[model samples]
Target: MDTLSFNHTALTAPNRTVEVGGRRLAYRRFGHGPNLVLCVRFRGTMDSWDPLFLDLLARDFTVNVFDYSGLGLSTGKPSYVKTDMAQDVDDLVTALGLGKVAIAGWSIGGIAAQVFAALHPEKVSHVLAIGTMPPGLMVKPSAPLFLQTAFKPENGIEDQYILFFEPDSARSRAAGDASVARIASRSMVVDAITPPAVMIQSVIESADPTTPFPDPDGRYQAFYRSTDIPVLALSGDHDIMFPVENWYAMNDLWPTLFVVTWPDSGHGPQHQYPELSADLIASFVKNNPRPV
Candidate 1:
């Protein structure tokens, strides 16, 4: 589901840019109904989102995808901040004029979602967090050490793609590299080194999530306790970043949550199994409609 294949003439290209935290945010939207905003994992862009999964989701809810400042079509490099990125979520919500919206995030973006929902529970309807941890990982290093190396830019972004994909077999790695490269090349049009740095900063900051806004100690708990919003915690059966154990720990902390696993998938279940992920989201939204 590459963007190139889309008939640009047929669909209206979403309006881009609105001031959010003094940074120009880049966002694209499709379909219409209840708004759905997808926050990318550390260092990801709207184009990096799986096209197949989005096409499936567009069948039901309106989907809005964007990048954090210093990444993708967004602006500001020196001003990039993790807490600011979290605030960008709310700003975009207001910019879009969405009264209430579902917030879904992956990896560090999940932490951003937690902060966003915590601060503005009234604006968020449901949160779908995929492949993320509660706060600290020094206590729970479920991920393999090799996985840490994957995040390092010296190893190259291709290595991270290999780590995130399912089966991750020799064949999978080869295919994923080719696939990731093509997509990244199209969306990341600006300077070569900038996008990677935006991602690195996000990771370095989140390494100590406790220092950031909303505070780490019981932060996830606070979000769960404070918000009436229903959450769907989804992770891959083979997720290496935030392992299945991390998900269990999170679920144990919040009993009301429902957990779903993609048995054949890895860190990126949505990419590996877009249809299934979309179905899970669609079902959750249907069963747990937000109040007006």
Candidate 2:
């Protein structure tokens, strides 16, 4: 299949690194609407965000995406503890001077979003959590077996998306899956060639799970009871990382929570349905403007 290119107005946003809790973190901005910050999942970079999705959201909101410390362009090695990353997010919010912004996260990014909202509800107007579970990894399974194996630590990131992208399909998922595979494979080779200790340290740090990790379930339950802010939780019916059941649990905790399930997608509704995602998000923002 051939690739098609669409032309549109583009902005080359600048990158900035700021000190957050004694560590440097990198970030970038684009689009032009109310401030919208997107935090990627574990080990994700700004590049991990789908360009098309960002462009669409940018049409309606000023979208900010960045690498947490130890990921992508950010400083330090990867750390699993969500609290540290949450602090990085807090610092990013301060560094960008984005006051009371709508915060969104994917996968583990959602966990960080939860932490940020719980810790600084005053600074967050709304929360959008996608493909994520509550704090303790207590979310139960709804994804298939193949996907479970795909996300395991040993499974090469190169094959991560195949579980949902449908390699046989001729759509963008297949193409994107291939692209990610190539990039991840190359990344693995680089890690293999470089000093393994540095990368290992990052991975170990990420594994610490200091922010609500050991007991995310109980903590999220408490956060739900405590938070008054509106939340929009989106999940893919096929997501292996965090399944639809997690969303159900969240709804049980926060009955008023706005929930959307992309029946045809897994883990990445933004990629599977960019227009729908953008429209829903824009409408969410319009309906729930910040208090004056």
State each model's CA lDDT, in order: 0.67, 0.67
TM-score, per-candidate, Cα-based:
0.80, 0.78
Clashing pairs in 2: 33-62, 78-202, 79-205, 79-206, 80-205, 80-206, 80-207, 81-209, 135-216, 136-216
lDDT (Cα, 0-100) at 227 in candidate 2: 72
Stretches of candidate 2 exceeding 4 Å from the true structure: 1-11, 136-139, 142-158, 163-201, 208-213, 290-292
**Which pairs clash inside model 1?**
none
| lDDT tens readout by residue for model 2, 174-234 | 6556445434433211211213344445656556435325563576667766577778888
- Residue 49 accuracy (lDDT) in model 1: 68
Candidate 2, after superposition: displacement of residue 155 in Å? 8.0
lDDT of 1 by residue, 130-234 (tens): 876555442345456545655566656556554676544664455456545545554423222444555676556545444322354666566675456888888
